[model samples]
Each structure stands twice: as C-alpha cells, then as structure tokens.
Target: MPMPGKYSLQPALITVADQIGFLKQFFSNCFRKGFEWTEFFRQAYNVGYRSTGIIALTGFILGFVLTLQSEPTMKQFGATSMISGMVSISVMREIGPVIVALICAGKISSSIGAELGSMNVTEQIDAMEVSGANPMQYLVVTRILACTIMIPLLTIFADVIALLGGFTATNLGGAMNPWLYFYKATTALEFADVIPSFIKTILFGFTIGFVGCYKGFHSNRGTESVGIAANSAVVTASVWIIIIDAIVVQFTNMFVYA
Candidate 1:
C-alpha cells in the first residue's frame, strides 16, 4: 500500500472543497437577484452613524500625538518651524486614513461580526429565507455598501480633525503666528498626496467590511460562537489593513519614483 502523505489530508481538502462550493453559490445569488438597497441603508446606519464618536476622538488625538512627537525630530533637522507643513503632509497622505481605518476595524468590524453571528446562532437568517427573503441582499450587500460609503467619509472627517490636532500641538510647543502655521500647511499640501490617499481608503473600507461579513456569515458554533466570530473579524480586518497598506505604500513609491 502507498504511504500516507500530506496530500492525502482529508480536512484541508474538505475545506477547500467547501469554499469552492460556497463561492459558486455566492456568485449565483449575486447575478440572479442583484441586490437590495433598503437593507443596505439599515446596515449603513449601524456601521457609519454608530461609530462616529470613536473615529473622531482617535483622529484628533492621532494628529496631535504625531505633531508633538515629531517636534524633536524637526528641531534636530533645524527646520523646527517647518513642523506645520510636515504635520499636514503626514496627516493627509498617511496618518489620517490609516488611523481611521484601524479604529473602524476595531469598532465596526467587531460589532458587525457579533451581530451577524448572533443572528446565525438564533436562526434569524434561516427564518428570513423561509419567509421568502434574500438573506444575501439583506445581510451582506447592504453591510458591504454601507462600509464602502461611510469609511471614506470617516476618513475625510479624520483628516480634518488630525489637522486641527496638529495645529494645536504645534502651538503648544512654541510660539508661532496661527495664520503662519496654517499658511505653511496649506502650501505643503499637493494633489499628489491628497488624492491617492483618499482613493485608497475605498479599497481599505471594502476589504474590512467584506472580510468581517464573510467571516461572521459563515460562522458555525453555539451561542458561544458569537465571541469567536467577533474576535476573528477584528483580527482579520486589522491584518488585511496592514497587509494592504504595505502593498499600497510600495505601489505609491513606484509611481512616485517613476
């Protein structure tokens, strides 16, 4: 008889087979019925409206912290007065979007995962289907759409708050005419930095939302499964964000250098 080997592993092959089947079904539904918008609104409210406060707080303080932390570094370069412009560029191109995304991944992703997991555990999704409802449109589409719409909006708000935070932190360190600080910041901002940062956020938002929904929607366990689902959602979303960010950074550098 042939020796047993890793290629003969049952569980891994079974999982791959299951995922392929799930993908086929998921695509079939997407084409057959398209999607529903009203449910999307409901999920949008939960994902976007509910998480505003935390995003704002994080955005503001992140800006402030970055500015304060960089003072010594700027001073070392003998361009201490250039702090305002540096803060503005940093916040616009990188800090603002990344920080906001991380916050959303923690708050909104976990909430979505737990909510969907609970619905799964209680058989609500099953009942909806039995009642002639499309659970895919009702559950996944709306949630994904809301996240895609709201995350960029949140990123914009975060950019503004972070700039304000940087503004405040700059003044705290030394005396500078307020207008001068803003003037320098205004001049430093280029279309190159601002536009790509904003555009990349849409991808980040979709990735975070998609992974969270996919994980929770497929989760199976008991009532205790809810915890696992939520935890996994946060971890997966965060990991994806970091991975995507690194890739985006490399891509951006290539374009910049070219």
Candidate 2:
C-alpha cells in the first residue's frame, strides 16, 4: 500500500484527470447522434427569455454608473461630449459580455448545478437511464448547447440596453440628440472591437454550462451535496470566465491591436 503522504497527493492528480475526461465526454456528447431539439429549445427559452430582466437591469446600471464615474474626468479634459462614444465602446467591448456572463454564472450556473445535483441525489438520473433515456444527451448536452446559443444573444441585448442607459446619462448634464448619441456610439465601434468579445461570450457560456453540469452530475449522493454542487459550480464557473476573458483579450490584443 502507498504511504499516507504519498496517497494524499493522489486525489489531486485524480481530480485533474477526471476533469479532463469529463471535458472529452462532454464534447463527444455534444456531437452525438441524437440531437434533442425539443429539449434544446426548452432550455434556451429558460436560459434566455427568463434571464432578460436581470440582464437589462445589469446592463443599464453598469452603463449608468460608468457614465457617471467617467463624467468628471471627461469634464476635466473638456471632452464631455465624447461620453457617448466612450461609454459605448467600454460597454460593447468589455463590460457587457463580462458582466452579463458573470451574472449568468451566478444565476444560471448555480441553478443548473443544484437542479442536476438534486436529480442525482434522488436517483432520477438512474431512473432515466433504466428507462432507455440518455441523461447525458437530454440534460448535459441540451443545457450546454442552450447556454452556448443564448449567452451571445443576451450579451447583444445587454449592449444595446447599456447604450440606451449611457444615452440617458449623457443627456443628464447636457442635451444630445438620441440619433447623434447612437451614431457616435456606432461609429466608435469596429468589427475588431465586436467580434472577439462576442466570441468570448461563447466560451463563457460553455465554461458556465460545463462547470455546472460537471459539478452536479458528479456530486456525491447526499442532501448537502446539492448546496455544495451549486456553490462550487458558481465559484468555478466564475473563475473560468475570468481566465477565458484574460486569455481571449490577450490574443485579441496581439492580433487586433498590435
């Protein structure tokens, strides 16, 4: 038998290997023969439509606060009129996707983890397995795909609403036409500014879904494991979102900005 100290390090290595295996299986299931369109649509509606209010509110407040904060600096430089463009670029390029994604991580990731954990604990997954239903396809694949589809759309929605919030803020200290504000905002953005950030949200969505599902689906059968799964899912998904954002931004900077 292994020494006590030697065995202590094994769990960490095993966990790392397990995570790698989970990722491979997730990707495989994603392309498996049976595509559950009905479940996908159902999950999409739940993840997307149900998330609108929070996204809108987050985008709005984010823009509102950023505009207010940047105003003093703009006024100091006598560039107050540039507020619209500044706010637009900031929201579209960074704030919108990251903030919305983090929020989704907190809200959707935890929900999915807890839901799956509860199902796992109750042996519902085993029941489904015995009844000829593929839980991985129905639950894991559908939710992951739904998140991947919905997050970018949500980010786009958030960006627009954020710009509207910025416009309102711009008008607070001085009068500016809505058309002029929108035009400035649009003109300030390029395909480069938009595309990479949009791409990041897809990764964010994938990370959120994968982490949540992995935590829940693999949770130990116990009443307390449900809470542990949800909590772990949120924390892990949020870290993955930040890490992915950093890596994507680094690549985008090298290629696009450099």
Candidate 3:
C-alpha cells in the first residue's frame, strides 16, 4: 500500500481525472446530439462577430508586416517578383491560420474562461443542476460547438484580409499588376497546403474551447479563481495548439505517405 502522505493526495488527483473524463464525455455528447442552433448562432456571434475587428486588423498587419519584412530578403535573392507569391503562400498556409488561432486563444478562450468561472463561483452552474438541467449541455456544449463552427470561418476571413494587406503593401514598390500577383499566388497553391491548414484549425478550435471550459468549470477558488481560470485558459490553449500542430503534421505526413 502507498504511504499515508502518498494516498492523501489521491482524491485531488482523482477529481482531476474525473474532470478530464467528463470533458471527453461532454465532447462526445455534444457531437452526438448536435448542438442548439440558436445558442450556437449566439455563441458564434460572440466569438466571431465580437472579435472581427481584431482578427481583420491582425491579418492586415500580418500581411503588411510580412511583405515589408520579405521585400528586402527577396530583393537580396534578386527575386523581388516572388514577394507576392511567397507572402500569399505564407499567409494562406501558415501565418493566417496559426496567428489567428493564437489570437482566438487569447481573446475567445479568456472570455469563455472568465464567463464560466464567474458562473461557477456565483453558483449559477449549481443552480442549473438544481433546476434539473444539464449544465454541461447548456453551457459547455454551446461554447465548444460555437468555437468548432466559427474558427474555420474566422481563419478564412483572416486569410483574405492578409492577402489584401499583402497586395496593398506590394503596391508601395509598384502597381503589382494585380493579374500576375493573383495568378502566381493561386498557381503556387495546392490542395495539400490549403486543405491541411484549414483542417488543423478545427483541432485548434477544439483545444481553445476545451481548455478554456475545463479550467473555468473546475475552478472554484472563489472570485480569484475567475482570473486564474482566464489566465490558465489562454496559456493552456496556446501551448496545446503548438503541441497538437506538431502531432498533426507528423500524423498527416504518415497518412499522405500511406
């Protein structure tokens, strides 16, 4: 048998394990039942509409900054003409996807965490339980489902804006001859690059939603826990994105080879 001290912390560990199990079950149930469309629309609006300005601005800056930064390098390579194609490729394949994910993790995850944490601390969740409602279904399912549905849309929108930014930035050197820039950018892109990227973002959305809800739902340390939940949500969501991305790349490559 374990020592008394060793066994003493077992309950806390068990609670954590139980919470993880609950999350998995919650996720399964949400997918199975199909989430509420009305609630989903509301939550999606919250996650997407509320954050539109930021995502657009970020995309714009990302495109502009990337072009500006690459101009000198491409010129050094004596390949200044490659700048538009290169920037568009980067934006669509990686920068737009990853950066938008990070931003959503920061903005949406924190908001969800704090909102849920507040509800938890205030006993609103308990009240729902007392009222004979599945709190997880009503709250967790809605937000998670919302993220799943909305993140991809947001990413696509960001990619467009980033491309626009790149176009505007390139115009600084000369009128980038819109037809050539668009053609090169489009021709250089393949389904492999575009499809894999958007697919990865679904998992990214799941991570942000899962971690945010998990932290907040389990946090009960009073008002203080709200802040803790928010902070942990952002941190965990961002970390999980990178870890999952690495795994996804390897796993996807195997499938491609297979």
Quote each prediction's TM-score: 0.86, 0.96, 0.90
lDDT of each: 0.81, 0.92, 0.86
Look at candidate 3 and give me any clashing residue pairs.
none
Q: For candidate 1, what is the lDDT?
A: 0.81
Model 1: CA > 4 A from native: 1-35, 175-177
Tens digit per residue, CA lDDT, model 3, 197-221: 8888898888888888888898875
Model 1 lDDT per residue over 138-232, tens place = 78767776888899888988877887888888878567787887898879998888777887788788877776777678779688888888898
Give the number of the best model, judged by TM-score.
Answer: 2
Query: Candidate 2: minimum summed lDDT over ten consecutive residues — where?
Result: 2-11
Ranking by lDDT: 2, 3, 1
Give the clashing residue pairs of candidate 2, or none.
none
Q: What is the lDDT of residue 111 in candidate 2?
A: 92
Residue 138 lDDT (model 1): 76
- Candidate ranking (TM-score, best to worst): 2, 3, 1
